[model samples]
Target chain A: MRRFATLALALLALGAGPRSGFETMTPELQAMQRDDFANPGMLWVAEGEALFQRQGCTGCHTPAQMVGVAARYPVFDAGRDGPIDLAGRIAQCREQRQGAAPLPTESPEALALAAYVANQSRGLPLAPDPDPRLDPARRQGEALFRERRGQLNLSCAQCHDDNAGRRLAGSAIPEGHANGYPLYRLEWQGLGSLRRRLRSCMVGVRSEPFPPDAPEYLALEAYLAMRARGLVVETPAIRP
Target chain B: MRAACAALLLWAAPVLAQPAAFQVVGDTIPASLTGTPGDAARGRAIVTTRQRGLCLLCHSGPFPEEPFQGDLAPSLAGAGARLTKGQLRLRLVDGRRLNPATLMPAYYSTEGLVRVGRAWQGRTVLSAEEIEDVVAFLVTLQE
Candidate 1:
């Protein structure tokens, strides 16, 4: 009986906290993520760097100036009146500064730019802006994360929070951190944004996914950034 | 007195039967799922196919033909000896009542959900007949 109690307590402790998806990956996958040449996600980062030059973004801001910029995204934008992620910010820059039409969300160019920008902040700890003004959106995101929905009657927390490290259909359930975006997934065989991954989760749970730039997604991103407070960025990550 | 009690229980069975919809009672479902007996063959097809039940996404079972099987949920190798038919029905109907945070999708029941896709609104993952079919197949797993 005493042994059983101790085991139960240990299990409870494991279930109570958050963990990086990196920790859950196999050694080979970890090595793949660590090596820039071998990581499939690097293809997108390379394309994004090229796109950045072609778009004339380098004329004003050098790559060095953009480094660590992604660590502070999903920040409150007064003009947009909500939190905007790096993808949204890239779209904003295209329209406002470059006098170019905003690229469609998840378009190759948008994904590339987002990937390039995120890669700049690679290795830096995620530190989304903590302004008090963004609290309401963050709270909404928290609620969305916990709210049960879809035909499954499940919340994101159901798997990511309670079942992190547990297997789900042969895939390990990570703590649902957004430290990686513009990540390359083996399942997708290409790069995808945070919203794209979120939409996939929604569909997996048989729920309706919001549009790419929906406020709900932004709120969710804000919440994820806050949740993954200290985790290092893993842009262009490889995952099964 | 014992005979009278037995008679009363039989007489009250139908009256107590929850109308079509499932009614969860604690950890076990105290009632049988359907009026008709389940067909194991039909149940097997539903459980194995991705278009219908998609049970293989999170469950591994005795089906050797299917190439990929999940290890997320417990294997259904000896499920017959493990749980009663009524209990299986409860899990199929709404597993949330058993473990509120379970990832198993409710094959039936449509209530208190949000952001449901337009194409799937008001539709349970599996129909009542399909639920019975799957349950029938699961109850046959003795190995």
Candidate 2:
């Protein structure tokens, strides 16, 4: 790890001329996910399962229905005028139907429930089933992805897709896949939702991160989940 | 009056064109360096205690004094000799300044400081003096 940091530092020194944005990884970040699951993040999933059972989520979204459910998230919801990710759907269920308070989007309770529910379909293929009926939501999500919002004037594609394998600052840009969601970020000290992850990125780019249950985030999650179609879901994965 | 206006413009221009609020010179270390032994004992306290650095939640160190720290960050057993004071300062300041995509938020950069949500807003998580102290403790880990 020390050697890796040295190599990265040397690279930074050589490239110290001019830069547009910050780097994302160093040896410190690389080691973040190596010892995952041992983190307190799993407790959220545990608690979420307890909450789910307590709330009788299986009564509506049964285990059989959920077998391939995680893979099909971020679908267009005609009701919301955007693709509603699983977290949004969960919050909706709690608020409207269950007569319960909405869970904080990035809070431990929300992350846990999302993990537990998403984990039920882990290893399932990502299969976003977008319908022509859902076109409006898809379009909204796509538009949001391309629109520059932050003070830094960056879009999601600027790093994730435009230069997928290229190194920015210090860390390499990933393929922009949502296959592993409900991920435990060592930086966050616990598990968080795909929505939370999206919100975090917004803040990173200096854009206004949406409110905990904001529709824009839900739409974005829908789009992201659709993009990961065919990839197997890996909930609660470790991220830097 | 004309000269006064020109001076005001000069100062205003520099302040206005100060580029981004944060400029990250990532890992810009001097070629020549010195070696020193760090007090792992003190580093342990800073990392483990929230009152001090509270770094244990996000990083793991080689502090034998404390048990049960997370490995979210690389071990700092030999960090003293590996990085310079300035380099460490950048990491402590806005670590994300080094990596735009970093999950590690700047411990110091208040650019995204949230007043409504944050218990401490409009302030860096740690002061420069505290960062220096933490760096000093890390630099002592060469032993």
Candidate 3:
């Protein structure tokens, strides 16, 4: 019975869910995220709103139509044979539906447009669909998250899971959830995507980063979205 | 004939003293490398700097003068007394071999890594000399 109790306790520890990075921010940074007018990320949302109409997205979908849509992204697209995030979906619409060229990943327009779309879902809980097809991708992402690589020999779990809230260098380590992506980072001084952040983390570990739309990144995105399923979307949020 | 033999022995002495390439035996490295001795002062410089070894980023030490020492990993205040030189060398070479999930970077290895930037590919995080230097410095932290 003692052995059984120990096993149960270990399982409980393993199941502990992740926390939002917002909780780890300084009070001043939290305040920056609260006030939309003062938030620099709002600038990208505003730019994205303009792009929505100029790019003819307004013809089929208004801002209200996009509400709560961002919360269900990184869904498996059978046509594409894999998962695609909101950013990829936007690029697809531009190419297939609007007849416009696909926006380059990480471009200002891409950041702005994604920010705008993500903004419509602000305050909604992330609810990625549990498509069975996504299970394989999710598994792969879980593997990637735990796999140690790079010169540092560190996995995402090493910092975000096992040592969350610990300090690395001078900065406090967060759980690394993707709830508030396309966030305005004080360091970047501009809007950035979750993929951009992931790329930076890859570089931090001295690992080569996969390209913007690589399957590995997509897989990682799929897992992050699933991991933050219950967290409220805080799109265009501020981060230090 | 005796004088010639003495001269030959003298010439071979320095070459024989050269440090051999590192070899891992299980988790611990053998103590005493065969190369030029490391400078503790140079090792201290590497540990404290962010652009180099950046050891202070995770591991704290007795350097009260350094304002931003981190507190993530174990403190290095008395590492010299706690671990032998061979153990320190192994940790610096590839810590993951000892604990498969260590967050410490392999300061002097170039294998089984992914996505290494173009400018840094095929290069270890630290040269063998740097590793020896760091080991020398770490072994001095007796208190």
Candidate 4:
């Protein structure tokens, strides 16, 4: 009987195309995401704009120049032998170009910059760099997504794929897309990185998570970007 | 050897279920860990509690008071009608023996688990008596 239910849900998933987590949120949340002034993440965007001027970023490039950069990220970095997301690129630029220290993951400064940069790309479609080099990392990310781990022995695909629209208690499981990240999660009551979100999930299943900035996270983000291709960016997206 | 250990422990130890200390035979354990029975009332509390059993996180049961119940796996509404007491016992102990890809956790075993949260390490999700109590309550869930 359980097999039959799984099979039915699988069939239902087949009929549904890739959907965003935004579509799963309540009406109140949707309204909050729609109104820029009401969205708490805009606060970070404002802070980041100030930091850009104070840190001399505005001297090198205007705010308009950074537009759409977030849409084509998790790029293959030949030097690192891995992919680097938009947030990583920011830190790299600060270190290599600006001669500054690296920002810790999900630090207030890091999230602020990520929100500011990503905010520019809002409404732009995710177009992951299709470099031939990224193929290996993308495949690795795909494998990791399907592989079962933790004491629960559940894979990411099991819930996100098989039961995309089903309720896991009170909340509906979104398709696990990566379009709206660096967004505010009410549960966290603050902004967070996608890696932070993924780690929470790993721990949720009683699994050990990779260290911060692990290649596995880069690979997964790259894979998710590829998977969520054409989906419009919703940086600083509000989530429940 | 395992059976001898089970026999020796049944006589020597007061607490029968000692965290991954039960022996398996075929698809079932075939005997109660305590050599007696468990409290169904206590078992119901464990199943309903969010922090302990976490059963409602995936399996909805006959509890009407709990407004939030998961639909991830099969419903436990008629678990007693669907599975025997021994079958249910095996599942609560570790469903991986039946299906390696199962999302269900081994409520009583701690071996082979990687990166268990610090607070949850070195202990089972439930004690032997708790398992028996849960089993007792489930068997009563004939509907």
Instruction: For each candidate, give its TM-score against the true structure.
Output: 0.82, 0.53, 0.88, 0.88
Candidates arranged by lDDT, highest first: 4, 3, 1, 2
Candidate 4: stretches off by over 4 Å: A1-15, B1-18, B111-114
Instruction: Please provide, for model 2 over B46-143, each residue's C-alpha lDDT reduced to its tens digit, 9 standing for 90 to 100.
Output: 55563345354335566566554434356666777787766765676666556765545465555643321222334444444445556667766674
Name the best candidate (by DockQ).
4
lDDT per residue for candidate 4 within B72-136, as digits (tens), equals: 88999889899888889999988888887777888777777766554455666677888899999
Clashing pairs counted in every model: 0, 11, 6, 0
Candidate 4, chain A: TM-score against the reference: 0.92
Q: Ignoring the other chain, what TM-score does chain B have in each prediction?
A: 0.80, 0.64, 0.81, 0.84
Model 3, range A131-177, lDDT digits (tens) per residue?
87987788788789988866566788888877878877667778888
Candidate 3 global CA lDDT score: 0.78
Error of 3 at A157 (Å): 1.2
Estimate how well candidate 3 is docked, as a DockQ score.
0.25
Misplaced by over 4 Å in model 3 are A1-16, B1-20, B24-27
| Local accuracy by lDDT, each model | 0.76, 0.57, 0.78, 0.79
